[model samples]
Target: MKNQSNMPLYQLFVHPKDLRELKKDIWDDDPVPAVMKVNQKRLDIDIAYRGSHIRDFKKKSYHISFYQPKTFRGAREIHLNAEYKDPSMMRNKLSLDFFSELGTLSPKAEFVFLKVNGKNEGVYLELESVDEFYLAKRKLADGAVFYAVDDDANFSLMSDLERETKTSLEHGYEKKTGTEEDDFYLQDMIFKINTVPKAQFKSEVTKHMDIDKYLRWLAGIVFTSNYDGFVHNYALYRNSETGLFEVIPWDYDATWGRDIHGERMAADYVRIQGFNTLTARILDEPDFRRSYKHLLEETLQSLFTIEYMKPKIMAMYEQIRPFVLMDPYKKNDIERFDREPDVICEYIIKRADYLKSELDLLS
Candidate 1:
């Protein structure tokens, strides 16, 4: 593997037989045993192909879980995203960092190069998985984490698939950690979101969710124009101390002036008021709507600007440019990749202008 760049290198040693089995069924969720060497230290791990459609790409993403008594930077699990559709390969990291800066809980990410059996796999984004270790790292109290696996996680009484009433409120979520009682906490939140009386909705829903945190997360998605983020590309954490559910961003590579297919998207693609049942209900109340408008206005003035974001974008772009140029998978799009910093900056300018005009509509 090339070492011209300063990005950390992770080497995975998978037995030929295990590699074949893992390749035999790309859709399989079960992990195959593998060994990872980093900083000259080898650790036993279980690795599985991750993602819904990206699994079919020539370059694949991976989910790695460390064995007992072994941890990677205090994390038992981590996600290595190929970011195949994104030429810049920095949107996910940028968006998450932006959320964290906005005082919202978001996953921590970094750029790293990977090699399998000593063959270069190019640049991959290493993301901190939102699980038990995540809570422990932040010194957050014990809680339940649920992943919104599909569009059905829309927090609606209606199903996104059938367009009819859902059979279960928990249709689209996968319980990551928590007791059986935790399930009821999520179900009850959904039930109240859809069935609560509008006059009493604000008082009731606020009791079950951290409205301020949710609105901040909503602003992140809106400012970044992540169309898919409102519905399913997030995780719900039920804080035991506060007993409120909070949203955390996930799978945001399709954002920042690009759609899921990596095509350029208009700056105004996602509206100031994002989609989904929970967001709609939250914004329906006068006080909450005002709060959201204020949040968006504040972010627009301070954080969501070319002045604030360009340096960060350029820093990541320059740091990864050398490595991306050497990547066989991204070689064809080096020219496009080189132009991504400008593309993202232009998007931020236009998106900010558009949101400023729409802020009045919230009132």
Candidate 2:
């Protein structure tokens, strides 16, 4: 196969001993020493395999952090997703870009070819790490950020695993940057979501969250049909200036007409209303419900159309096709990869229609 890809290349050089130790336990959270060579510059980094089930894959995702105060592209850390299950390998980037276009806070992403020890590791999605740097880069207010690690981050009083009342309200969140007081703030918000009276829920909840931003994020998940996204697969950033929690999307490779396993998903798999305690409470109020409905309708008519999305989808597909053809890991899915653009465009049409039909429920 001819090598015709123009994507940026990242080279990782790890000591043989460290490489062995890193591979010995893919499930470990510890980072091994490595040197990353990019654009003819070498920097010391700590590398670790990231993600839950993805660690079990032959080609694994990686999390890279600088040794100290060093930064890469204005980011202290970065996540390189293998996107092994996504035949298209562009869904994560596309979904995140969509969120940004919708005026929602989302991590930026791009395609990059990865090589380890001079051996080709194939195409990877390089995602901006949502941390203090993320806020600084965007010139956003200083805030506390937390990752929804699992389903327990569902903004509920109950545990997702045992379905019992959770001992701690912060069961599923891992604080990325925040003080102890931030934890209390999140707990208080969750408590209000589940316990606030119906008449006062809207007013009280709005005080803790940016309802418009949350609604836009919810619409992105619903349109993309990421079923697991409702409960987790997101980050929460509490803006210090406004004192309101806002959502940032993460790990969206399981979207764009496919389930986490990369199987075909129906357009209506996720409802227009979305899920979770916080979402439900927001939609319960008549004014908020109307705002969400209007937002969804506008999105359907504008951004979610084939006319609007096909060009973007095809651009991504074409850019990666040359690389995909040469990718060793994607050989089995070459045909499927070629078909993904059309598949995703068709999904956009079907999903838009489904949501249009279900819009009455919101009314």
Candidate 3:
């Protein structure tokens, strides 16, 4: 039976910790326990009516919201999160650091090594709580800042209007060319350009005239050889009423090209076809082209000079290589990826040249 009362029981299996001791210390002596002890068994943890049910939460990453029971102490409502089972505790930390460097705001997470249950070699991550933000969907417009995947379109859930727009596009129809500005793409480029007015940029924070900073970032992404950076894997969130927006980038599993070297992994033209589509659809406008071109040049020169991001990229590569590298058992599964190195290298070279062209214009 589906429970529609906004509360549901969730089963959580935790590698046992000092939760038992902690619970006793907080609740046993309290006049009224904040959290009721529901069930605890060896390496098994369960909670009943503990907090609000989290929907759309999945392994690896999730956002949780919780309200305090009337019996609990101090705060009225609180939220917390956990990331568990990482062997090196690399992904969570790297993710947090990457987002921070990119100026994306998110809840802080700390690495926690769990070895309390008489079991060794366990690791977990604890994260600070964040409040839920309502989502509003809008249709992609002409010169609209949008991302299309290499293959699929049904990535983010579409509202009725967006669905209708996509259906209309799939037919012979198209959004009138150059009617609207690709605002988000423009924003991204503006940050990449030199002498661009700070007020013109739409970030909530100060707009730094720092193209070198962005160039290093681009180099990092290229060195990592992430192929899915095109539109479908990235997007923006806007609060319609406030008009404030934030970019949301997702999907990284396609990166690293474990079966192939980074050069070949980055050259795959099939993987990079989205670049042409993006140029045609989003960068087709004269204003966008001019604006982004200026930023592109600045970004290129900066990346060409910086030697640090290369090592950072290499360090990151070494870090995740073991987890993603092709193994003897997985040879049959990964053979195809190994066959095509130029496919990846070609894409990276093209991307580098594109950036260089844009930068050359400035000189």
Candidate 4:
């Protein structure tokens, strides 16, 4: 019913069309140039399809990056998420806010409407992209190497796996910064994690990793029940100045009582201890286990409670409701959208209770 008439000029690709496709089999087109608009002002940006399963769906998510101005609002790139699975469209925003409130390095998010070449693509979440620009904004050193983990990044020692050829360091990780050395920075640490004596794992690992931040990050994942985040949907980086690895949150649309494919998970989806190889082994350490318990208890008492979270959810609902009702590409209708906040509200109440019980059993 709408026409996307004019395309902007940043449609150039240094690489050939076939080579630049997101995957060899799919998406052979170059990034389309579009003027990203909010209200009436325009942002000069190039847009491309983002994500695996979501890309295949009719309601698509996108990656927005700059060409000329090269940076917009202090970000080199941005993400325009369909928020397709989330009926309430508050899961990722809520998760990020929860992490930020705890003083973690979380991405800044805003809800915006995307008018592609003046055609309404519907209301979407505009998120600050993770890059050198993001690290710089937080005053992190320029040389900090950023790597993204996804479903394939099992955190297992790739060296131990039986493969025909040598694997690239960039296999599971999507590298962001251009490190001068092509050597795999994280492989040794990963190998040591699985091979080291259980007694020494905690101490040895903490030397190269920010164990405290990792634990808090784990606590956030468990508290939110972000089932997919344990393996993927996270960014890992070794601070250039500090040389210690840190975890960064990503893709929370699958969180808050849901799975990657938009299926409803049990409210207590991720309560168990052995979620991932790396973090689970650390949690087995007595001191770390105790710290995790304290963190969860503190969260349940202060951050994760329904009384504290409900109002935030309600606030987000208020802002997005009008756009949701008007969104032509939204997966669900306004009535269904209206129904989710109440359901998510109840899920939060139940989830907090379930996590408390799980923590007690562990203690």
Candidate 4 accuracy as lDDT:
0.71
Quote the positional error of residue 346 for candidate 1 in Å: 1.1
- Compared to the true structure, candidate 2 yields what TM-score? 0.98
Candidate 3 residue lDDT tens string, 264-300: 3323332211242323322333444454555445444
TM-scores for all predictions = 0.98, 0.98, 0.39, 0.86
Model 4 compared with the native: what TM-score?
A: 0.86
Model 2 lDDT per residue over 123-216, tens place: 8999999999999999999999999999999999999887999999999999999889999999999998899889888789888999899999
Q: List model 1 lDDT by residue over 1-363, tens digit each.
A: 336657998999999999999999999999999999899888999999999999999999999999844787899999999999998999999999999999899999999998999888989999999998999999999999999999999989999988999999999999989989999999999998889889889889988999999999999999988998987899999999999999999989999999999999999999999999889888988899999999998898899988889999999998999888767799779999999999999999999989998998899
In angstroms, how far off is 207's CA in candidate 3?
Answer: 20
* Backbone clashes in model 3: 18
lDDT of 4 by residue, 1-363 (tens): 122222111121323442245444345335656565443345666767787777776667778788657776688888878888777788898898888876567888877765543445676777787778888898886654555555445566552244423265445677777464523557666667768899888888887778878888888788777877777778876776777788888878877776776667797667647376787688788888888788778888998888898889888888777666657876357888888888787778878878867886557
| Residue 228 lDDT in candidate 2 | 87
- Root-mean-square deviation of Cα positions for candidate 4 versus the true structure, in angstroms: 5.4
Off by over 4 Å in 1: 1-5
lDDT of 3: 0.32
For all candidates in order, the CA lDDT equals 0.92, 0.91, 0.32, 0.71
